[model samples]
Target: MAFTLLSRSPRLVICALLCIFLFSEVGVPRRASALGINYGQVGNNLPSPPHVVQLLTSLRIGKVRIYDVNPQVLSAFAGTGIELIVTVPDDLVPGMAASASQALQWVTAGVRPYFPATRVTGIAVGNEVFTGDDEQLKASLVPAMRNLHAALAQLGMDTYVRVSTANSLAVLATSYPPSQGVFTQDAAPYMAQLLRFLADTSTPFWINAYPYFAYKDDPTKVSLDYALSNPYHVGAVDPYTHLQYTSMLYAQVDAVTFAAARLGYGNVPVHVSETGWPSKGDANEAGATVENARQYNRNLLMRQVSGEGTPLRPKLRLEVYLFALFNEDMKPGPTSERNYGLYQPDMSMVYNVGLNQLSTTSAASLSLATSPATRTDVRKDFGSLCLVTSLAILLITQALLL
Candidate 1:
């Protein structure tokens, strides 16, 4: 009788363990303040808007930024409670700036149709206009923004939808010590005008800061661990402010803050409009590996969930939007340019970075694909699975005894 009972206990224990593990995994609540993702549709093979909406909802990503106002995407996102930031293309800036009526028409046609239902929270005037050599477009960016704001105000949507433009980190002439950060001389006048508008309207200064570019350009000087925000990296300290920076992303953010302060708009909030690490790249691309991407994104997501702020603003949580939600095979530039996505064209993950609905096979595949060094680092940094497994085993053991 004791032998019979012991044999049945093993099967019962296995069943109980499976049940407990499933319950624990599914019962975990998602973070309330999750970070945002940039949904770029430059690729032809990307999923449809409905499928994309379902994918984002499954992942519990509540905020998204898109390059244009696609009516299909906007309509699909209606009633989802997912906040959206849409953009006006560069070509439209000149015309919009030339006439307030044109701006009003653009807003009415692109924004008013699906706003309250779709939760359209912001409108970007143009992307990275300051980094380009187009003097005319650069000159028109502020005026276009002002016109858009006025249009929104006329329609009673100004309080809900903010207007601003995203700038690349190349606009900064100096960003080393965080305290000595400043915009280039040529960009200063345009930046001051833009900053005044932002300050007056209580809008955020959007910056696309890519630490990968810095590391790729000078791997000998830039630390890969620092870029990945690994705990093992010994970070740098800004001499003037004495603020220690564990991650290049935070340092870059504070640099923008200081730059804004120099223009007498120190209190204006800064938002990361685009930032991400590619899962794969060409042979020449440094620190572009599956493991490094996992570490960079996972660490960044953990920080976002923790409501972390830059050294300059301790109380206000730094809002960030991860770049390129889907890998765009058609994106022009280096190999890394096409591979910054957390997901592939088929909606499969590039690696397990704590996203929802990931299968056990996907997780195991990720472990096998990464380098041994990254495997070790991942094991050290991410212990949530191990904790869950241990707890499930303990619960099963208790149930078997009962």
Candidate 2:
């Protein structure tokens, strides 16, 4: 006979769930721990670094990737227990490659001071360098990553903090069919060698895949449902693998897997370093609307919760860093460039994924606001409000006199 545990009361189940929310490690349930956020700060009016840290910690988000190592942010995250992935700006690549000691010094200065307290977990060396015009930078990318890894190894931080670099989809010349994926001819050799390095080091291959770009660039061809993860057409079938793909994002991911397989490093894991749809956009930038944004992220998060894998790796859950945490005002390009955030500068949700205020109330006791002694930024919120009010009064008096 099949056996089952004696049933618990409804009240007990609710209480058990509450305990899991407030006290579980990362407080996101064991299954959701793998999801991550990309914390880009190319804007002037974002919440103070401390508040940003608070917001992530309060929401129980465990993994986050910042585009650059801003010390203020690093300092703010100290003791917050959020696993941060820090980045090295492109200009530093040549220097990091020229000397291993320099790499060590850079890490010592940028990463060492905030250790167990800050929960820094990874270092991304020079993002998208392979796709840039700087030939010198492209050449230095792998060596720089290797030296940085070596430096971390020397400091005994390599085990916990891995070294990696993020790549843009531009690296691939043809990615539509998935199975026939191939890297750009000029980038092929370097990518092959880089794949070998990642395979040997057991590090993930980080790719910044954006299905929105595909849909926008060829609106006549790409399906909106395929891009937004709605019930849609069977998108494309990989000729070689014979796997049918239903969405552009999954097809994009499988393309990377196929490309790596072509290089004989098929076992190396691929992670999405950035992917999100904008809530607003210019007229010609089709598919960048709040509805699409909500659908895309909501469906993506649901798939993540299900622990589903790409067709290439059926059992392994795909790790993703959602494109951004805040809408960056200073980012160049079309209007869509600044609108990928899931939250606005004021820390309000752009699109709710069932994290309503009521559901998160029990979690409020575990919020960062409770730990005033641990972070001064939470306290600064009051100070900033006072300052803004004072300025507003001054402006009103001047207007009355005029």
Give me the candidate number with maximum TM-score. Answer: 1
Report the C-alpha lDDT of model 1 over 244-345, residue by residue, as the tens digit: 899899899888876775555555668899999988889999888889888998888777766677766654456888987999999999888999898999
| Location of the lowest summed lDDT over 10 successive residues in candidate 2 | 1-10
The candidate that achieves the highest lDDT relative to the unseen native structure: 1
- 291: Cα error in model 1, Å: 1.0
Clashes (backbone N, CA, C under 3 Å), per candidate, total 0, 1
Return the clash pairs for model 1, or none: none
Report lDDT per candidate: 0.78, 0.73
Q: Can you give the lDDT of residue 14 in candidate 1?
A: 35
- The positional error of residue 134 in candidate 1, measured at the CA in angstroms, is 0.5
